[model samples]
Target chain A: MVNERSGRAALAELVTSRSVLVCVGSGGVGKTSMAAALALEAARRGRRTIVVTIDPARRLADALGLERLGGEPLPITELIAASSGLRSGSSPTGSLHALMLDAKATFDDLVTRHATDRAQAERILANRFYHSISTTLSGTQEYMAAEKLGELHTSGRFDLIVVDTPPTRQALDFLDAPGQLARFLDHPAYRLMTGSGSAVSRVAGAAGKRLLRAAARLVGSVALDDAVEFFRAFEGLEAGFLTRALAVRDLLVSAQTGFVVVTSARPEPIAEAGYFLDRLAAQDIPVDAIVANRMTPRFTRLTAAELRRIAAAQDAGGDQVLRTGLAELIELTAAAEAEERALAPLHTGRAIPFQQGPFQQGPFQQVPFQQVPFQQVPLLDHDVHDLGGLEQLRQSAFDD
Target chain B: MDPSAFFTGTAVHLVAGKGGVGRTTLTAALGIAAARVGLEVLLVEIEGRGGLAAGFGHRALGYEETVLAERIRGRSLRAEDCLVEYLGGHGLGLLTRPMVDSGLVEVITRGTPGIKDILLLGKIRQLEQARCADVILVDTPASGHALSFLRSPQGLLDAIDNGPVNDQAVAALHLLQDAARCQVLLVTTPEETPVSETIETAYRLEDEIGLHLGPVLVNGVLARTPHRDTDTGHSNPDDPDPDDPDAEGRWVRELGIDRDLAHAVQQAAVFGRRRRDAQRRQVLRLTEQLPLPRLEVAHRPDGIDDLGALAEELLGGLRAW
Candidate 1:
């Protein structure tokens, strides 16, 4: 059996003590809200925390009671107390900051940082391909998120950095993005395109040349030439990007980092969570917790005899409307029971939940828990738009 | 235009929604709805997920179309496969293996932004032009990328002056911008956040992308129970019935109901009413904020069991719209 109390304690310890907390999940799972709430909780517990989110809905700002969040870090410590239903000027000992990822802007910043000079950066940024793919590319946002996370962590800006990953079609994209970019940088296609005047001929053998001709013909020589120019401009920046990608990958797997897989209790999201957990396990990454959000509350405590008695009473004296209401309640209760049954696999050790980290002595070190702490946040009566709602959600998530 | 034509007459229906809003299930139901009207339907899965096929109790779909139901067929389209097909059709098949191996296809399809989306849309356009099906339902990406995915054609037109890819974008744009030929069916749940996102996406798709908006499908709506006093003067369910201050007590005494049972039932009723009221407020907000018509599917906590009933409900809504 899972140790319920220790599981919760380990989760809380990981949240407050870990330097990096990555919240990964599919879309519409309240993953963003959970990230924000956990950050708020960490700050309330007296740790300087920053939540970097890629939420498209802008709900993070609403949850933090901010009018808007931007590319830079926005100090939200002062508003945390009020947002959490406390009086003004009663901010906690710690601080909270929020950063909303602007993929294009972050990408441009990376280009400028890694490029050899301002002119090189400008050339790369000005390329037609770069202009479009910097933001619109499928994996650009995910890669940029990793880059930003590495930047913030390396800058030593905060005690805790909570990352809200992008809502990718496959949740694993967030984890795979850095490697994908690194591989692309090392790919023969990139090498072939970026090879200088003489090197191009050497790199492009007869087959390669013929392939280029065919591609050039299909997309037109002009478009192919433009792409080649873009890659050529980007030639010298590969080393810097590859170095940072490797560094980010290391930081993600470091002991200071912890991953919290957030998911709703729905069948699809739960299954997605299972897939994420398995993938992380395969990678030997430690998943500190699984926050199952928006769980249906079960009322199965009412025994069948009790329900039967209630039904009998309703049938004896109730009108048609009362009968309909009773039937609806019974169905709802049954469904809630079924939902609870569906969640059994998550906690039954059917899925691998924990991985042993390297033996290290620290506050944030893995505590060797028997199971990944599975926390269920009940579906709220209303959407959490502000701090008070987050406070309510936090209590549901962490409270026994 | 006749409301029923939204399903029968439209050549392409691109169904999009934030993830977890039941977009796939609704697409399947819409396909069923259209098929019931004597229209052949093709369901296209863009993300290569088995969700659309799973809706029809079929196995995972591939590049080739498989019959899902009597009048419905389903398939998935990937950028790589579409590229290969385009090359093969143009007698440039020899370039496929080398280009794919050298990662040139990746650089071209993915490296050039919007190229993948344009390729997929171009293939969809071919299916439409060929009259492969009377109605084509594309299960597009989630809301986060749906905008950029739909906007790719227009974006490419401005970026690429002229080329085969540019020509493809022009053709896709032609199909996307034509109202009678294509319209986007946005799905959202009856929740505050989903509704808000739906409104924003709806307007953006219409204004920025210049795409036609079909009726918004509000999935997971709580069905109103019969014999409720909702129609009575009480707008808020929390407001107590002035006639019964202690209804639970009365039930316990008159019907021999246990006090605990009576209280439990009362609690359930209150929770259900509040949730239903909240759902109604969101739907009303959607109706007011978005000028598009709405089709609502009631919540089935167990899941969509009866596609026929759902199709009928959708048809009924379309008829009213």
Candidate 2:
């Protein structure tokens, strides 16, 4: 069931050939670490690479040897130089950079860039409604992530860009963001809100006007006026925003981009990965590989009956210590086997009956996409928190 | 040591943790545990695809509560639905259809940043005040958004001065601050990243949000016997244990085990030992860093099918706590 060649070759191709690699998975599944390791591989192969991470733990920063990452890309090759043990000339063309996504700051920058004038930008920026939406709106962060990717891709400074997306279904929002923004910009209600006349005056019916007044009263007229002003100021910038949003959409589905779905050997995350594969396949975005992280090592194939016989014999021999020890060993092997069973749907074409119900199948059961590599990273004894740990991860992921 | 008080002492329990830390499953297990104590429990999941209901072996949950078990009811909440409900409560019931269908609610929710979260909390507050259930278990968003979700009420209170929305925020904030009304239950695994995030989240919740926290749940900890690994003696035939004479020979000859099998089992044992040791260190670190009670849930080999067993284990943990 282990296809080392395909897995290694696919990973190599991802870093070497693809311009953009977006790693998506449920939270706490080591998606961030996997992304960083893949970016490190690209850097080591002499391609300039940058990894854009979202809400990574502090230890992951320490792992990458960066003191801190903010909105701007910071060169990290020098930071990891001492720990990585690289001589000066080895892969000299290779370079690595990293940045943490600041969604609010990115949105503000977009507003400043697209606005017709500084006064218009300031008018919108100073509005409380604008401030709130930019920081707290559901799709803003995801749209900003897509915008940042588009920015970096246009910069053409790096050969490879790896994005560690936000967790769960929100990661899918990052894909829909561009189109959602474009559609909203074109929505008639948005135009009505930003219409030149007073919003109440523009409503044709008494009921429409009454509901608008009620909404205004519920949120308070002061706050509602601020929203009106913000949208009015935002009207002229729509063309630029629309053009950029469409460009981002184009970049996401282009041939240079690839999606790598990361998951663990757990049922929930595997189900999530399957959902992601189905979504991406529906959109025709190519998935480069599926990384199954933190997999327990399958050490033995011995059944519980065989192990119980050994333990019972040891019990008869009066070596109770050996008996208990063998029992614990049996439990460990059984657990490893369970992990393998959990991961089977990702590899085997057939669906097996779970204790609860039939196993949920993903795009892995379908053809062509079944050719996508399944790279399994064994659960290491120690937690991964530094460049050394990342190097170990890279070795396991890239080396056959 | 009685866990009945833990169930009915608070009106609402917000179960929160990083994604994949089993927050939803733990919420379901807590509801089951509460129901076992003869309390009617309402499991509330926000912006999820019926994960809480699925935990109880049911289909997706809607806005209306459905009986999931003997005494447990579950429902799912979305921001838009909460807004519609909020509007209806404000005597705008007739306006809901046109407003929702016309994208006005979406516009209002999008225009205001924290309003969506505030609306959800406001609904939860209403549920608590109306005594809809004996206990309400809210499975909140993952840790990344949990802070913002909890902070939204206060954020709205600061942003809006005099309005119905402001009044709602104040009420939600009051509920969150009232120790008898609500408490957050944090869940984490005995791993470096999760433990670290849990500790940070605990302090932030206490200091920033001024919210009361319940016991920290250390989920998926490896359960081990209190026996030393070396006491099993060496399985290496090339280098027999001097402490236990002919231990290897006895294992292969008397125990009917081959040397290769013994060696493989020995490696497996070593791996298990190391994994357990690492987790122990993490648990110890969590104990030393945070000043809260810790509840340990053992790893389940059977996965989702073990929720009932986990609920029983949680009740045992609460009893000990």
Candidate 3:
């Protein structure tokens, strides 16, 4: 829970009420875990849900107790069965589903499904250049995330979809994926290359052919022929590609979409989160929640002056028992104070929420980000590799 | 026993790790360490927001190589510039800049799948072969991107059989896969997730990319619970509150502080010790599971404030190993 005004109700609404929840943040703040936990929590709430991860090097499959993840979603029935010591049918509202995005396979599926003719599809699919480059393509992962979301949404298979975006270096790249894909399809150079479809374009490209003939004399004939053939193969599908890319872009900013930003309280990560928030605002994407993971734990309650006076009394009176105990307290107090100092910068744009009492500590004070509701998850005692660990994280997320 | 021997002949020294694990700091420190050994070092940052320059106490560096120290220089590599240089190599010098200006460069770099990484690696490979420095320290992208960046050469080679891009990929591969010329050092924290990823990345670099692996540099390790190596530690570390009846009575009566306060302090110390103990267990797991040599740098409570001091500390650690 972030605070009294907003708490787990916000998370509950994001998971159950919304059609799609996209987790966005800088890299390495446990975004995968948060996404999985949200999906599982939604499933427990009796909503059919699936969480998709676009991180190429992810352990989401391992975290969900599956050996591996592929393009299709695998229902997590056996793991839930193992957890409650019951059979696979014990799951409520079916079960949660998970899959890692296979960029190459998804693109292939798109081509096969959308091509005008089987032969046209086969030519595009079997092109040597397409076969080699699709898997390790740079921007295809982000492009496919949007495409897959649109696919799953139209299929009506899952009521709620939780998606995890890749940790992109440039903050705008992920949001700009659909536009970039559409732009690529509509590029002048690309259209010039693939304009072999219409008779008008074919006759118009005669000048281009003459220019290419001159260049072919300068370069190798075989290489230019292969290049021309690769582009011509996709001529039949160019219009479909542009229209689908534009629709995917529109689906990203649709009313059903919501974004959740996850980050840590560290200085660098906070700045990164600010950058992400700024970009989202520019793009007009609604941010639902902010999750701050692995915040430093606090254990001290008394003020510094009070602790010093107690220490002075222990030293003067020479009681070893009280002295040793107070000494331990002092050391721990210092560590807690240092942690507070580390998080001080993030406390900007908000008043210090601390209030000192005689002996008892008050409720936990929170520093919300830009007045937006946010939840904080403490670092778990162990790494989460199985359903049991994920349950632990879920409990912490709701409790903390 | 020779610390410099690990880096003696390696021309391309790459520093990589999970994001937010201080890869940039370690790369700068390693570059300075190599430079101190009378080796000319160039610290290269590709697509980064000048983390290298910030570390060296300078304003953000640009495309041009800027000297930051006595024996070290820094360069921020961008795809557009690297592509221009690459095209100019093929007798297209006149059309390169205009192509970049008309926004055709981004479409080629971002739209054409593996061209961006291939171009970046091609640039790095050129510097390596040119012997621009005795040791070229590259601060690479975070783990997943770094792996793909290294894989671009082969990806392009497979996609285009024998074009100019294929030639560039072949050149990048020769520099990356030559174990005697290139070595990779991975940095990680003593946490579970980062360590797990570090282990996986190291395997991929060796098995897939075939780059030689160096010692795993563990950062942010803490000191023993109460007793630190420095003087600003607890007054008494081993013994908690000493048990003297007279002292206890005087403090309880005179200070007016409740027994709850003492208990709170005791709880805090226990938590501190427990964290340190957990970290030790994590470190042990890395050592037992990984075959690579490991070097640990303790957590600086204050911080590594200056790059010069950090370089000195890193040099000491390297020599002691």
Say which candidate scores most in lDDT: 2
Q: Model 2, A1-400: lDDT tens per residue?
A: 5464588788889898989999988877888888988988888878899999766344346457555777899887653453365545557677889888888899899889888899998998898888888888878878888888889989999999998887768787877876787666655456556654455546645655565677776787777777777778888787776677778788778888888999888877877777677678778787788899988766566765677676665546555445554666677666667777788876764443321212233244443445778788887766776677777888788875
Residue-by-residue lDDT tens digits, candidate 3, A21-137: 888777767778888888877777677889999888765875675668989987886554544432244346646789898888898998898878899788878776566446665
> Over 4 Å off in model 3, which ranges?
A1-7, A78-91, A170-174, A196-227, A242-247, A302-369, B1-3, B35-39, B97-112, B226-258, B262-274, B300-309
Residues B270-308, model 1: lDDT tens digits: 667667767877888898899887878888866434678
Ranking by TM-score: 2, 1, 3
**Candidate 1 chain A lowest-lDDT run of ten:** A354-363
Query: What are the lDDT figures for the candidates, one per model?
Result: 0.76, 0.78, 0.69
TM-score of chain A of each: 0.85, 0.87, 0.78
DockQ of each candidate, alpha-carbon based: 0.40, 0.45, 0.29
B227: Cα error in model 1, Å: 5.3
Better of 1 and 2 by DockQ: 2
Give candidate 2 misplaced runs (Cα > 4 Å): A1-4, A56-67, A78-90, A196-208, A303-305, A315-325, A348-369, B228-257
lDDT of 3 by residue, B1-321 (tens): 454675676888889988867788889888887777787889999887666777676766778899999889999898778877877787666655545543445544453456777788888888987888888888999988888788777766665565577777788888889988888889988776678788889888888878888889888776653433222323345554333334445555776657666446545545555556566767777877889887787665433345566667777777777
